[model samples]
Target: MAIAEALLAASPQSACTAMIDFSGRVSKNPKLDIRAPGKLSLSHLLGWQGYRMLALLLSDVLALKMAWQIAAHFNQFYSPLPPELNWGSWLRLPSLFWLFAAATLLFFAYGGLYSSATQWKNYLRAGKLVSMVYLLSLVMGYFYDPKLDPPRSLFFTAWFGSVVLVIGFRLLTTLILRQFEQSQSPIPVFLIAPGDRLATLSHLLEQQLNFKGQSASHYQVVGAALATTAHTPTTVQTILASKAKEVLVENLPDTALASALYWQLRRHGITLRLLPSSVDMLHRRGLPEIFAGLPTLRVEPRFLSSLEYGLKRSIDVFGALVGVILLSPLFVAVAIASRLSSPGPIFFRQERMGLHGKVFHMWKFRTMVTEAEALQAQLEACNEIKGGVMFKIRHDPRITRFGRFLRSTSIDELPQLFNVLLGQMSLVGPRPLPLRDVERFDTWHHIRHQVLPGITGLWQVSGRSDIADFGDAVRLDLYYIDNWSLNLDLDILVETCRIVLFGKGAY
Candidate 1:
């Protein structure tokens, strides 16, 4: 790529500079035309993210006050003290309470509670930080006065209350602020991808803007360029000219192309979202280590976070059970509509590859005619997926009028909650492939089957049926497995809900 070579030319010590020819090609020569943008000042940092952080900080302060009052109330009831020593009865809080609250705020700030980059919805993180602050305080107290008899009731109550209240208030704060964020300006974004992906990525971003509206931070694609030009002087100039605050990269080649582009954009305070392909993604999962005094990238096959995985499974079962109960009425309505729309059973059960290639019957509300399976052979030519591995069409003959509605809204997949309940699926993982699609998969594609299938996944929320290439979809699935976290799962679930609600990409 031209960008890789441009990096060396753009270096401060290099005699040969970079130049962009009229043909849109980067050439190594004297005097590069690229102008490095100035570093962002502290004033520029206070955007929407800054305002959100301030709001969260205000919530934390209020939560700490409430927790202190609650702890004091319970402590007084349990163990009354003499009037002179009863500081809880004072007009202002005891000096100890103020000191502890100040320490708690400092700990929270250090824990990234007020950072915009931290997951705002991660209530667990806030609770953990609160607990840590209290634990540290207790340890310090023990060392300070070993013989002093501290009020156990007040100390324990304050610690527990702080944790619970902080998390509760943070959740409330996030919900309230979300309503006000809609009026904010859309984030200007530049797009970078291979020629084939340029249109696809643009359409996906446009779809998100149209469907979700302003419920989320909307992005406007102010500029686009070939991924090959990513780190080139011309690309930098174009991005700067467009005044894009963020750049979304798709399938960028694995090389210095990324490093150079990152540094180039970082200097200008632009965020780079590199949604790399499978090979680069696999490289990302490796942990840097030293073997025999030589640096190496160690890729472990098994995840060491057993406790988190257990928590994930617990959430899956609980969420699935609750979903089934809550959506039973919608299920009944869809089943009735399906029966009246087509001459077929209300449910469709098809064999799908699950974890470790275990075959299971995946359930869905029937959205096609009874003869849909037999008719597949005739419709193969109409498959819209880039590779023949997966079958998809923008419009199919087998779908009944009502079936279209079901498929678009993803109501057809509601029955998969039962699969999740049976441990055949997760609420968030890779989408299981039909036996027909799996049969045509390349060797590497089977890696996705290493985890339980899900009713909704990265693939569903990223682009759904709009994604034409089976390989791109598989890359997203692999990315999910390699970087799985509770916060990531929550992010996917939230995006899935928004996409499904708007019926943006599904056929």
Candidate 2:
């Protein structure tokens, strides 16, 4: 309660002004305010609020139940104790047993176990809590009633059983709530942003926030304050006319404007939030924090940590090794075909820019004529794609007969396994572009090099050559960088298989 109060108090009222560069056209009329989505009574809120209480009650009951069951199992297995030395006997001493159970619950609650706001949060907190409770119970038993406590060998079994029971109860509850939400009530949301920012916010909300019966039904755009360049009113009334339950401001460069916006929204009894900046959006950073007595918002970057990188590398090496072994026959066959069909080396080696702009030799099975690079300039007029980076004809005349089959099957990229094993590439990540392509990239495009390049990535699986827009390509790469996770990588791998089998977007 104290923490929640402190957090609420730390957030201050802010005033905001929305400005538009409308081709320097000045209008005497005020900009119209539009309403989008507002808060709604969500069914999930009921489940979220009551889950902690239910979890605690369930944990206590399950722990006791498991304790008794384990005690019975121990008596059956190691029968130095009589059959009567079970839960029934323990229940006769109800005062002692209940006291221990109460202590366990208290210990769990104190360890920040029952304060979770989400299902994953609950499970993680519960696991920690149950472990703490088990340790406390063991300590208390060792000190107070060693003789009554079960054998040390059974301690782990009892602890394991209790954890399963607690986790099982939470999972079951989550399943029930999910099913109910899927069948019935809609999730409610309020969207607040400037007119220009509303479209992007709406797209995001539709993708992430629209749930079941509730969609973003209301959107409110706060109009600019009526004032000259110098001395604008920084109060809530000057900006917002209608009462907003939540306020979301687009990323404003002026701290004064941002602070003013926050103040005005809060003054109108609204919960203030800021639309993530382009940097934040690209990095996928979560909510900003409100520090005590500070008007400034501090947002933490949500990039993959070093530990995550290490885990990804481990998976890469393991997967690459397996792939190399499993696909060696295909590799041999492609090598023979390339050598027979082309007059050059079986493998085409080219320098490509990798992580941190480092240059490395990338290998691919020869998929074009020996003079394909020389023919690129002549074929420029025939190029179908429009971009600074080079993309040849999909059915380029320079490609060898067998090269077409190799390119379609993605067998041409097999030599990249050597690059993966060399720590120059990953099994999944942004594609490493040639140095020529990297040189042509603008400042924002350099972000793809922040991580090691991959053999198959978001681009390859997300339509590859089919996507003609360079901006979309860069966005996909940025999305992969920002949202990189083991599970996401696995999903990409699965998608890659489907893409390969169908050769959907291959040239």
lDDT tens per residue, model 2, 8-98: 2432322224232111122122121001111232322344434544655675677567765775576557645433233445547655446
Q: Point to the candidate with the largest lDDT.
A: 1
Tens-digit lDDT track of model 1 for 1-507: 233233333434331233222211232221221112334535335887668878887898889878878877878778864343244543666566666777877766645466424345668978887888788877887798665445788778878888888898988888887787777787777777776666666666655433334322466778877665564666787888888876766666543232235535544555556552413643564444332122333332221123356677889999999999999999888877777777879999999987666778999988888899999999999998997999998889999899888888898898999999988888998898898998898755765665677888999998998899999998887677656767788899999999988998988
lDDT of 1 at 207: 55
Off by over 4 Å in 2: 1-307
What is the C-alpha RMSD, rounded to one decimal, of candidate 2? 16.0
lDDT of 1 at 378: 98
Residue pairs with backbone overlap in model 1: none
What C-alpha lDDT, on a 0 to 100 scale, does residue 139 get in candidate 2?
Answer: 81
Which predicted model would earn the best TM-score? Answer: 2
